[model samples]
Target: MSFITLNITCSEEKRELLIAELSLFPFDAFEETETGLLISCEEADWEEEPVFAVLARYEVECRVERVEKVNWNEEWEKNYDPVIVEDQCIVRATFHEPRPDFPYEIIITPKMSFGTGHHATTYQVLKHQLQLDHKGKKVLDVGCGTGALAIMAHKRGATDITAVDIDEWCIENSEENFSLNGCDHVKLSLGGIETVQENDPFDIILANINKNVLLDQIGAYSERLKNKGTLVLSGFYTEDIADLMAEAGKFGLVHQEQTERNRWAMLALKKE
Candidate 1:
């Protein structure tokens, strides 16, 4: 299918804000350019008003265009680079040659989906995941873009891994990634946390989505976590940590630690 592309030019300082704001819309994929961002959404879901509204709110300039269907995988292959975390986990595309020294290798084809391990949030989460004991544990990967985290969890011996995302593109991308990594046991689903039944709680939950979605679903995350379970969160600035911690505290989730990269922070919370 074709897509509506929005070439947004904003101040470097406001780039993250614009990305966050645009995510609330139906926009699906984003690529950071030297001067701005390239965002796209399915033509059927594109709405001019919301896009213009967001640009106006940020006081940014934009150019809209209709993008014809292209070979996304081929495009990604040309630009995609492998990411290695702490020399333990490596995330790479199938086209790239493997580095056998890394204990865990996750092969992914991130066609419009996020969480390719190049992002600081995903990198920090992978670093923290290496520290945890996922062997035979039940894991829930919320907003599992590219299913990178979920696949990593499976590689780390997580027995019951459930990866969920609201975007159908993410679901499809994640499924292919899971299969690429030979993570057949990782269950891929399309929806939010509410889609998962309450009867099954999780030992570890990973949420790398935006702040608003995290805030809105903090309670649900707490409810779904088993006693003394772990919750790793990201996709927000370091400044937002205090507020997020305060909300998690209400549900007995104690702040364990945090990692940051380029002002983006990933928080580790433990349910008491």
Candidate 2:
């Protein structure tokens, strides 16, 4: 499907507010421009009502356009760069040279998928993954964009891994990436949490989806995790910690630690 782009010029304060509101909708990616925020999504999912409703609250200039027949990977290649997390992990594309120095390297061709280890949420999660133990363990990666987290778990020695996402493009892109990283054995599902066929509870669960999605799926996460298993989460601001922790607590998931970067937070919890 084609993609629609919205170029919104609003005040600095309003920029973030718009992002938060638009994120709740079907928008795929948001980029900050010199004038405002540039948001895009599949044309099939684009709705003018929500976009205009949010824009109506503030005084701003908005431009809507259709990007015809664009390839997500090509678009990404033109504007993307490699990301380094904690100086230990390097996320680079095939076009970039290898960095043999870093202990762990995740090569990604994100396409239309997220989680290139560039966003603060993704970076924080990957950094947290480095600190966790995955050796000979089973891992579940919810909202597995680009399959980065699952591949990292493999690099860290996870024996069995399952990754799930609701987007078909993401599932396709992630498969390419997993094969590129030599972890194609990682199972991938093309739907939400319910599509995950977890006959055995996981030892570690990684979820970097937004707050609302995380809240809705926390119970499922709880049921899928083995006792004392770890759950690492991100994709919400630092302030959302209380709400997330509260939801997790409802299912006996105890908060053990947290890390914040540029206002985005990653919380690690253990199932009790």
Candidate 3:
């Protein structure tokens, strides 16, 4: 199926805000470029009036342009590259070179969207995953885009691990990556936390989804977590931490640790 590509070039101060705003839409995929942002949704006619309204809120000037239809999958694979973080892990495109030095390797074909691990949310989870004692423990990675963290946990010694994402492409890419990294035991599933019914009472639950999603499912994590289990959450700005903490407290979860990079934040909590 063909898709519409919306290209918007705005100022640096407004780029992040615009991206966050666009995320509310169900875009097939999106990318942030040096000059602006590019968004793709199933072929549709976008009224510039609404876009202009959104821009006015931020007082940012934007220029829109149309580009030729292209195969987004092929383009993403061609542009995707292995991203190494903290010299301990590597997030690579299936088509690129792999580095053995990274104890954990995640093979992700970004496709229309997802993966890349450059986002602070993914990086935060990756960093905290290193600090976990996954030695033969059962782990669950909810919203496992590209399965980067799930693969890492397996490599780190978590024998039974499951990675779930709503995107079918992400599930497919993650499976290919699991095999590529010699981590075949890790299960990849579609859907949200509901797929976790097959496996329950996990020793650790890792969720790096947005704030709203996290809050909605916070109870599910608490219910499925083994006593004394750990829950690591990211994908929200630092300012939103307070609200998360409040909600988590209701689930008997207390903040144990936190890490921040750029404007993103990660919180580690333990179930009482």
Per-model C-alpha RMSD = 3.7, 4.3, 3.6
Per-candidate TM-scores read: 0.81, 0.79, 0.80
- Residue-wise C-alpha lDDT for candidate 1, range 1-272, written one tens digit per residue: 88887777766457667766778888767755445677788899998886787789888889888878745456456556788899898888888898788899989876667787867788889999999889999999999988998988998889999999998989998888888888877888889999987788999999999889999999999999999999999989899999999899899999899998878899999999
Model 3 spans > 4 angstroms off: 1-27, 32-36, 41-74, 77-81
lDDT of each: 0.85, 0.85, 0.77
Q: Point out the higher-scoring one by TM-score: 2 or 3.
A: 3
Better of 1 and 3 by lDDT: 1
In Å, residue 8's CA in model 2 sits off its true spot by 8.0
Per-residue C-alpha lDDT of model 3 across residues 1-272, encoded as one tens digit per residue: 55666666665335556766766666656765444566676556554566668878877656554555666656555444466778888887766776777776777655433445766778778878877899999999898776778888887899889889997877887787678778788887889997678346899999988899999999999988988999999888899999999999998999899988777899999999
Give the runs in model 1 whose Cα sits over 4 Å from its true position: 1-70
Query: What does candidate 3 score on TM?
Result: 0.80
Which residue pairs collide, candidate 1? Answer: none
Tell me the spans in candidate 2 whose CA falls farther than 4 Å from its real position.
1-78
Residue pairs in clash, model 2: none
